[model samples]
Target: MERGNRESLSSSPAAAASASSQAQPQPQPQPQGLFLYHERQRLQLCLLHALNNLFQDKDAFTRADLDTIARQLQLHHPPQQKDHKWWILPLPSLVFKPHHNALTGNYDVNVLIAALEGSTHQKKVIWHDRRTPAASIDLAACHLMGIMLNTSVPRLRGFWTSRHWTALRNIRGVWYNLDSDLPAPQPFRHETHLVSFLDNTVAQGGEIFLIFNQD
Candidate 1:
């Protein structure tokens, strides 16, 4: 997530918006009825969980789907344009693939982009500029699809760090936080609350992504 795939922003998370003319607001996402699909934390696969939550479908994405994307990305850009080898035992492709953690699922932004853009529904993902508030854009005009958030977290005795994945979705005019870390989906009292919550999240080492149906 550092910089291997141009998937992460090197600047502090506080500066989430590097380009923006004004402010904005995303769509309203909430469960339709008594059901909500969410995947809990397991094997460091928050990105996988977040994607499913954003789509509001348990089978929206799978670990294998993400794995294949990571490998393809690696194959397109190898350090030496050949398989990495040491002695006679071929090195694992994971060693060269930084798009994800391989065994678990620390998928980077590149993987996220590829996965969603590859979706059959023709959905798209774009990074939000936190410098501009959500209310700046006219997402309420029925354009936004969802929001995937990446927050920085400490790891390995607070020495190293990793990003956590979560998402806010708009389903039928309501907003819900489908964070896999949470026991259940959390609905926002109103769109204002949703905007405030997102601003605060990105204020401290986080990135916001706006998902849409098309360009």
Candidate 2:
């Protein structure tokens, strides 16, 4: 009986080890692509919400308005040559002014659209970009251009500078940087690299437009 009890104790540990191994949880595979897609969708929704909040009393935008803008942008393909001097779209009304407060950055898309649409060649009224931070103006410009061109504006990482509101176009998978003061569209690399370059420039107190590229 003692021998039998010893055998039982020895086998119990093996049984417990087996049970422990069986109860261990396996690592689940992460759905990275799905997560990214959902995140992009959420960002679009957030942009829409911000726009609604900004223009709720004014000419508010619906999802259809955004879709319409995106469709128009997709159809309007600008010239992609680096030597072309006339590549800059004439946004005469979208001028920039220095702001004393650095935090005055407008992130509302609806306000941007309204400003663009309501702009007249005669009046040339001062818009949000005039008072807002350069980074915010450039970001809004990129988003507006991206929607117009039916492209996905990739996420950017960089600080704001006092550069004027700038817009870049991605034509046939190539990037063309646009500045009103420049004579032509400047060719730049992808979004990540551009943001890194901007970050370095900002650290040195050099002003540059925050660049965004299509995915």
Candidate 3:
């Protein structure tokens, strides 16, 4: 597969932001019958692009960094080398900052729930991860939380000074990546929405078929 090669795909960050703006209003209603499954592929491609943007950062692919990120993100199955031998096997992984998770970062659940809550009056749908310790999240998980939540971007830029740049330049950190074959992080599909839609369909004597692809 080629990297960043699609003409149909958005080429610039500005283009991506444009697509997001357009998609935000009047989110297309979930299709019915067989067509519902067809959207899965489209969703996956969007997800892959989103994850690429989320996890792209400066970091080394070291074991210690991977361990720390996995612990922070509550990721299961930390990376391991074949036969537990040192310097004998090459591992593949995605690297990112120590404080964030590749999937949704720290603020995913909270932001998602809040967004949904403001949009609808449905019952709250809880997120579950088998690898997570406690089953809840808050809003502080966003990397630049204060800038994103409390102030406008233009105002935030005004706060970045030479002192901040100097401090960042002095920091020393190794880059590490987590090796995994999992597909991209898909969009949050609220279970309540799914259940409610499916129930309404069944009441109408409509048929449903579930289609899935594992790569």
lDDT, each prediction: 0.69, 0.31, 0.24
Residue 38 CA displacement from its true place in model 3, Å:
24
Error of 3 at 95 (Å): 4.4
User: What would the per-residue lDDT of candidate 2 be over residues 1-215, giving only the tens digit for each residue?
Assistant: 00000011011122222211233222233543210000001222333332332222213444445554543543464324344357676442132112111122312333334334542211121233223333443432433332111112223223432222334444445444332222223445566655454454445444332222222
lDDT of 1 by residue, 45-89 (tens): 888888877876767777898899888987786555565446755
* Count of clashes, each model: 13, 2, 9
TM-score of candidate 3 versus the correct structure, residues matched by position: 0.17
Off by over 4 Å in 3: 1-71, 74-77, 83-91, 95-195, 198-215
Better of 2 and 3 by TM-score: 2
Candidate ranking (lDDT, best to worst): 1, 2, 3
Per-residue CA lDDT of model 3 for 1-215, tens digit only, reads 12221111111122222222232221233332110000111111222222222223212122233334445444453344346457644332342323233443322222222322333322243332323322132312322111011111112347742100000000012111111111111221343433443344335433222211111
C-alpha lDDT of candidate 3 relative to the true structure: 0.24
Candidate 3: worst 10 consecutive residues by lDDT?
A: 163-172
Cα lDDT for residue 171, candidate 3: 8
Candidates, ranked, TM-score: 1, 2, 3
Best by TM-score: 1
